[model samples]
Target chain A: MTLKAQHVSWRRGGTLVVDGVTLQPAPGSTVGLLGPNGSGKSSLLRLLQGIAKPDSGTITLDDTDLALLRRREVAQTVASVTQHADTDVDIVVRDVVRLGRTPHRSPFGGELARDERIISEALEHVGLTAKADRLWHTLSGGERQRAHIARALAQEPRELLLDEPTNHLDIRHQLELLELVAALPVTAIVALHDLNLAAMFCDTVVVLQHGRVITAGPPAEVLTPELIADVYGVRAHVTRDDYTGRPTVTFQPGPPKGEVLRPLQASTSVRSA
Target chain B: MVVGEQGRALNALTLPVAADSPSRRERQWSRYGAASVLTLGGLIVLAVSVGVAVTLGPADVSLVNVRDILLNHLGLAEIPVRVSEDAIVWQERLPRALVAAACGAGLGLCGAILQSLLRNPLADPFVLGVSSGASTGAVAVGMLGLGGSSLGLSGGAFLGALVAFGLVLLLARFASSGTSGVILAGVASTQLFSALTSLIMFAFADSDEARGVMFWLLGSLEGMRWNDVGLSTAVVGVGAIVCIASARSLDAFAFGEDVAASLGIPVARTRVLLLILTALLTATLVSIAGAVGFVGLVLPHAARLLFGQRHARVIPATIVLGAVFMVWVDAASRVAFAPTPLPVGVGTALVGVPVFVLLLLRRKGRA
Candidate 1:
C-alpha cells in the first residue's frame, strides 16, 4: 500500500516540531527515517501513524484521507510498534498479542478461531512461540520489544510503523529483527539513530534535520559525509565495503573550528585541495 | 546465567503440565481451576453464612428449624410445626440476609468499576465519596424532612448522589491531566461532600430526627423490607450489566489512556457512563441499608487475587465475593451481641480491615 504524507507540518506550543515534511514510501518496501535527537523523527512517525494530527497537511493511504477514517479503521490499516508499550497487568504474551485484534472484535465478545490463528502466527513469526504463555513482566527488554512487534504483526496491517525498534536489542537480535521486518511483504517505515543499520536494511532513506526533510533517496545517495556533518554537526568518513557493496560511514576527528571544511569524498585529491 | 534460571523459574511457575495436547490442556485446566475454586469458595461461604445467620436470631432457632423454615416456605416440606419459629425465620431474618447479600454484591461491583475507570487500585465507591454524598441526601430527607411523602429518604439520597457524582466527574474533566488528575479530583470532592454531610448533621443536632441521620450514617440493615431488596436488586442489576458491557474498555484502560484510545476505545465516554452507574448503585444501597463501608474497597482486590486481572472475570467474581462477605458480616453483627443489634456497617469495617491488611501484606511479600 502507498503511504504518503503531503507537506505535513505540526507545532507544539508555538514551536514547530515537524515543518512541512513530505514523505512517500514506495509500495511494499522498507523505508528508514534517520535523524539526530530532537530532529522530530518521533513526531513525524506519530503523525504518519495517526496518533497525532498534523497542524496543516494531508496524510493519505491509497488516496483515502487518513483524517477521514475512524481510529479503528486507521488502526486496521496501519499498526505501530511504539517506544512506550508497558502494562501493569499480568497478561500472558499470547493474550497481549491477541489485543491487537481489538479493532476487529465485537464489544465484549470472545475471539474467534481466526483471531487465535493470527495470534499464533504472530508469536511464531517473532520466534516467541515458546514464550507465549510467559507473563509479560518477566520478559527482558529485547523480548519485550519483540512482543510489541508480534502484537503489531497480529493486526495483519498493510503498513507497519516502528520507532526505534532496536532500542535495547543486542547486535544479533537487532540483525534478526531487521531481517524479519525486511522479509515481510507488508510496507514498513522505521526510524533509527543507527545510520549503519539503516543503510544495511532500508531500501529508501529519508533524512531529517530541524523537522525538515533535508534529503531522501536511496541510502547511498543521501548518506554522504558532508550531509551528515551539516545535519548532525559531526565530521564523518564514508567508504564502500567490498563484501556488501553498501556505503559505510565512519566518524573521524577533524581540524579545530574555523578551519576549512574537509570534503570527505572517496578521492583523496579532493580532500587535499 | 541468572537470567536463564529466572526465566525457567517463571516458566515453571506460570505453566501447568498435562498429557495429550499438553500445553493446551494445561492452559484450559488452569483457567478452569481458577474459575471453579473462586465460584465454589464464594458459594460455600454464602451457604454457611445463610445457615448460621438464620439460626442465630434473638429466638435461638436451631439449624434444623432454619432449614425447615426455608424448605417449608418453598413448599418442599410442610410448614415448620411451629408458627412463631416460622415467622422469625420467614418474615424477619430471611429478608434481612438477602438484603445484606445484595448490598454487598452491589458495593463490590461498584468498587471494581471505580478501580478500573480510575486505574487506581485504591478507588471504591465509599472512598471516592459517592456513598457519603448519597448519605447526605438520605439524611436531608430523614432529618430535615425534605421529600415528605412516598418518595422518602431514597429519593433524597438519589438526588444527592447524582449531584455529588456529577460534580466529581465535572471537576475531573476540567482538570484533565489523566488518571492522577481524576483521582485527585475524587479525593477533593469526597472531602468537600463529607464536610457538607457533617455540617448538615450539626445544623439539626438538637432534633429527634438526628437519631435516624446518625443511624443511617453508621449504616444499618435493620428494619429492611422486601421492597428495599427489590429496589436494590433492580438498581444493582442494571449497574452490573453496565459494568460487564464495559469490561473490554476497562481491560484496554489497564495499558493506560493513549493505548486505549489507539485501540478505538472512547475512554472519556466509557468513564462517564461508569461513574453514573456506580453513583446510582451507591445511592440505592445507601438509601436502603445506609453507608456500609469496606466491602467495596476490599472485595475487588480479593477478586483479582482469585481470578487474575481480567475484567471479565474480576467484575463477576467481585460481585459474588462481595455478596458473601456482606452476608457473613451481617450475620456476625446480628449474633455478636445476642439481644442488642449492632449496625452491619460496623461489623463490615471490623471484619474487612483485617482481611484487607492481610491481602496488602501478602501483596507486599510477593512484590
Candidate 2:
C-alpha cells in the first residue's frame, strides 16, 4: 500500500520541470502538493500517476518499481483526475464514469453486475446519483469536476491523484469538493492552487519552488506567511480559522515591493479619493 | 471490502438511498433495451435496403425474383427463374450493392475510430488524406504505367494510401503531435496528393484513360463482381472485430492522451495500431470502390446522434447506418440518371452536406 517517489527528477524539452523530489503519501491521508505556476506540481502528479516517467529516479508502489509493473496493474490501484478533463463526444455522465472500469475489464467483455454496482456506488459517493444520465456537455464546471472525481472513484482505486480539481469552481463548490476528497477512504495526493483550501482540507502539505520541494509538513507549520511570500513572491497574512482550526491565507491587494505599477497606484489613490 | 468502507463513509454523512436504486436500474435496462432495439432495427433496414436496391436497376428485376435468386444461390430453395433476371440479380446488382455496403461500413468505422482516437469530430479517412493518396496511387499506376507490372492499381493505391498516412503522421509528430496537428498534416497531404494526381492525369493519360480514371476517382460501382464483394466484406469484418475488441481503449481516449494514459492504456501503442488499421481499411476500400466521399465523414456523427457516445454502441451503429445509407445512395445514383449514372461520391455529397450543416447548427449553441 506504499506509493513512494525517491529522488525523482523529470525534464521537458531540455528544461528541468520536476527536480530531485521525494514524496511518500501515507495510506488514507489527503496530501496536498502546493506550488506556484511552473513549480512542478502537475509534473509531480504525472510522475506519481505513471503517465510520465521520471528521468533520473524511481517511483515505486508496494516496494516494486512502477516501471516494472504493467500499466493495467498500476491503474487498478491508482486512479487520476486531471485538471482539465473535457471531451466533445456526446457522452453522458455514466458513460464517462464507465471509463474508470477500463483496467478491470477485458477487451471484449460486457459490463458485469459487479461493475454496475461499483459505478452506481461511485456516483452515489459523489452525490451525483440523480444526475448520472445527464449529458456531459450540459454539466456545470463544478458538476463536471465532481463527475471526474466520481469517474476516478469508479476505478475502485486505493490511491487517487487529482490535479487542481477545484479550478474554475465557485467557493462553495470548492469547499464541498475538497471536503468530499478529504473524506474519501483512499489516499489522495492533490495538486492545488489555493493555499487556504489546501490548508483546510489537506492533512499535510508540500510546497515546491523552481521544481524543488521548499517545505513539507502539516499545513499549520508549512503554510506560514513567510513561506508563502518566499515561494509565491506575494505578501500574505496567515491566520488559523477559528471554526476549522486550520491555517487561513489572506493575500495583500497591492503588488510586492519594487513592482508597484502606475495603474495600481492610481487605483489606490482613486479609492482613497 | 472497499464497499463497506464507502458505506461507512456515506453513513457518517447525509446518505442518499440511490445506491442500487430500482429506478436507476430500470433506466439502465431501458438504455440497453433501446440500444438493442436500434441495432436490431438497423440490421433489418440494411438487409432490406440491399434486397430492394438490387431490384431498382433498368433490368426490370422484381423483388421476388431477386429473393429467389439469392435463395437459389444459397441453396435454400429451388425456384425456377428467368436467365436474364437471375443474371441481373446474382451476377451484377447483388455484388455491386454488397460492395457499396461494405465500403460504407468500412469507411464509417474508420471515421468513428479516428474521431475518438484523434479527439476531433472532423476526423475521417478522407480528412486524413488516405483517399486522396489512394487516388494518386491509382492514377500513377493507370496513367504513367508506374508499378503496373508488379503491383496492380489496387496494390499501388494501397501503397500510396499508406505513404500518405505515414507522411501525415510524421508531419504531425514534427509539428505538434496534437489533434490539431494531425488534422493539419492530413490537409497538407490531401492537397499534395491531389495536385500530384492531377499532374499525372494532365501529362500522361489519354482522353479514354482520363475519362475512366475520372469516373473511378469520383467513386463508381459500375462493374463490381463477387470477388470484390468477398474482399470488401472480409476486410471490413476483420477491421470491425479488431475495433470492437479495443472499444474500451477508444472510450478511454474520449479525453486527451494524458487522461487515457492514466487509465492504463498503452497510449502510443493503441493509437498507432488503430491508426494503421484505419489506414489499411481505407486503402482497401478505396482500391475496391474508389474514393467514395462523405460516408466516412458523415455516418459516424449520425450514429453518435442516434445512439450515445459509447464506442461499443457507436461503432456498431455507425457500421449499420453507413451500410444502409450507402446502399440507398448508390441505388438512387444508379437509377435517377438512367443511362449516364451519377457518381456515388457526388450523390453522397448531395446528401451529406445538408446533414453536416444541420449537425453543425445543432451543436453551435452547445459547449
Candidate 3:
C-alpha cells in the first residue's frame, strides 16, 4: 500500500501550521518525520491519519482518496498511536487491546476466536502478554506506551501512524519500540524528535521546517551538518558509521560569530554512505 | 502434546463437549450465568426487603401475619384478620416499600449510565439538576394550589425535569469537547435550577407551602399509593433494559471519544440516547418519590468496587444493591422512631452521608 500526501496545507486558529507538504512512503517501508518543535510534523501526520482535514490538497492510500472513506474505514486502513494516552477508566491490558478489534466487529457480535488470536499475537509482539491481566493504572509509562502500540496492532491495519510514540519512554524501551516498528510488515509513518534514532531506524527521512518539507530522502543525505545548521539553527557535525553505513549527527556547539547559515538544499538527494 | 492433553482433560472435567461444542456458545453461557446470579441475588433481596418492611410497621404485624395476609389476598390461603390490620399491612406498608425499591433501582441504573456516558465517576442523574427541576415543579403545583391533585403535582415535576434536561443538553452542545463539556454544562444548569427553586419557594412563603416544598425536596416514600409504585416500577424497568442494551457502547466509551468513534460507535448519538434515557428515569422517579438524592450518585460506585468497572457487571449489580439499600432505608425510617415515622428521604441521607464519607476516606487512603 502506497500512502501519499499531495500538497496538503492545514491551518489552526488562523495560523498556517502545515503548508504545501507532501510525503509518500512505499508499501512495507518505514518513513520518519524529523522536525524541530512547532515545525508541523504532528499536524502533517494527523492529516495523513485522517484525524485532521487538509485545507488545500488530498491524502490518498493506494490511489484511493482518504476523504471519501468513513472514519472507521480509515481506521481499518491506518491505525494510529497518538501522544494522548491517559485513560479515565481502569481497564485491564487485554481488554484495552481487545478494543482494537472493535472496527471489525458487528454491533452485537462478541469478539471472535480469530480476533482473540490476533489480540494475543499483538500482545506477544509487544512482550506484554504477561501484563495483559494487569490494570492500566498499575503499568509504568513505557508499559503504557507499549500497550497503546499493542492496541494499534490489534486494529490489524495495513499502515500505522505514530506521533511521538517514544516521547515518555526511557532509552532502552525507546530503542526497543523503534526496532519493533522497523521490523513490522506494515507501512509506517513515525514522527520523531531524536534525529539519531530516526536515522538509525527509518528507511527514508522527511525533514520539515516551518510547515514545509525542507528536505526529503534517505537519512544520510538529508541529515548533513549544513542542513542541520540551516533548519535547526544548531551547528552539527555529520559522520558515517563504518559498520551500519548510517549517518551519525554530532552537534558542534556555536557557529562562527556573525557568520550566517546557508539555506537548505531545495532538491533531496539519496546517498548510500 | 502433554499441555494439550491437560487442557482437554480440564475442559472435559468442567463440561462434556460434543461434536457441536462451540467455545463462543460457552462464553455466552458464562456471561448469562454471571448476569443471572446478579439478578437472582437482587430478587432475593427484594423478597426479603418486602417481608422485613411489612413486618416492621407500627401495626405489630409478624412475618407470619404478613405472609398470611399476602397469601389470603392472593386467594392462596383463607385467614381471618382485622380489617385495619390488613389495611396497615397491604395498603400502607406495601406501597411505600415498593416505591422505595423502584426508586432506588431507577436511580442506580441512571447513575451507572450517566457516569459511563460522561466518563466521570461523580456523574449522577440529580447532578444535572433534574431532581431540583422536579422539586421546583412539585413546589409550584403545591404553592399555586394548581388543582390540588396528585396528577397535577406529578405532571408539574415531569415538566420541570424535562425543561432542566433540555437546558443541560443545549448548554453541553456549546462545549468544544464531549465529556468535560457535558459536566460543565451540568454544573452550570444545576446552579441555575437550584437558584430558581429557592426563588420560587421564597416567593410563596406560607408555612404550609414551605413545609410541603421542603418535604418534597428532601424526598419521601410517605403516603405512597399503588399509582406511585406502578409509575416507578415501569420507569425502572425501562431504564434498566436501556442501560443494559447500551453496555457495550459504554465499554467503548471508557477508552475516550476519539477511540470510541474509531471503533464504530456513533459517539454523539449514543451520548444523546443516554442523556434522554437517564432524564426520563429521573423524571419518573421524582414524580413518584420526590427529589431523592445520593442513591443515584453513590450506588454505582459502590457496585463498581464489588464488580469490576465492566458495565455489564456494574449495571446489574447496582440495581440489586440499590434496591436492597432503599428497602432497608425505608424500613429504618418506619421503625427507628416507632410511632412517629421519619421521612424516608431523611433516613436515606442520614445513611448515605456516612457511607459516602467512608468511600471518600477510602479513596483518599488509596491515593
Off by over 4 Å in 2: A241-243, A253-273, B1-37, B354-367
The top-ranked prediction according to TM-score is 2
DockQ of 3: 0.23
Q: Which ranking of candidates, highest DockQ first? A: 2, 3, 1
> Using lDDT as the measure, which candidate wins?
2
DockQ of 2: 0.40
Instruction: Tell me the DockQ of each model, to 2 decimals.
Output: 0.21, 0.40, 0.23
Q: In model 1, what are the clashing residue pairs, if there are any?
A: none
Cα shift from native, residue A185, model 1 (Å)? 2.2
Residue B1 accuracy (lDDT) in model 1: 17
B1-367: candidate 2 lDDT, tens digit per residue? 2456446554533344445656666766776678788889888999999999999978788888888899999999999999998988888899999999999999999999999999888787777789889989999988788885788777888888988988988998898666778889999999999999999989898899999888888899988999999999999999999998888899999888988888889888898788889988999999888899889878999887766688889899989988998999999999999878999999988988897788777766553
| Interface RMSD of each candidate, angstroms, one decimal | 8.9, 5.2, 8.4
Q: All candidates' lDDT scores?
A: 0.79, 0.86, 0.80
Least accurate 10 contiguous residues by lDDT in model 3 chain A: A264-273
Structural RMSD, model 1: 7.0
Candidate 1, CAPRI quality class derived from DockQ: incorrect
How does candidate 1 fare on TM-score? 0.83
**lDDT per residue as tens, model 1, B1-367:** 1354334323322333332455555555775577678778777878788778778766888888888888887889885358988878778888888889889999999888888777777787875567667877877777778878765877887777777777777887888677787777778877887888788889876666777677777788888777987888888888888787777778777667766666666666776777777877887788788888888888999888766787878988998889888988888888899677788889988998899789778867975
Q: Sort every candidate by lDDT, greatest first.
A: 2, 3, 1
Q: Of the pair 1 and 3, which is ahead by DockQ? A: 3
Per-prediction tally of clashes: 0, 0, 0
For residues A231-272, could you state the per-residue lDDT of candidate 2 as single tens digits?
776778889889988889999865544545343224323323
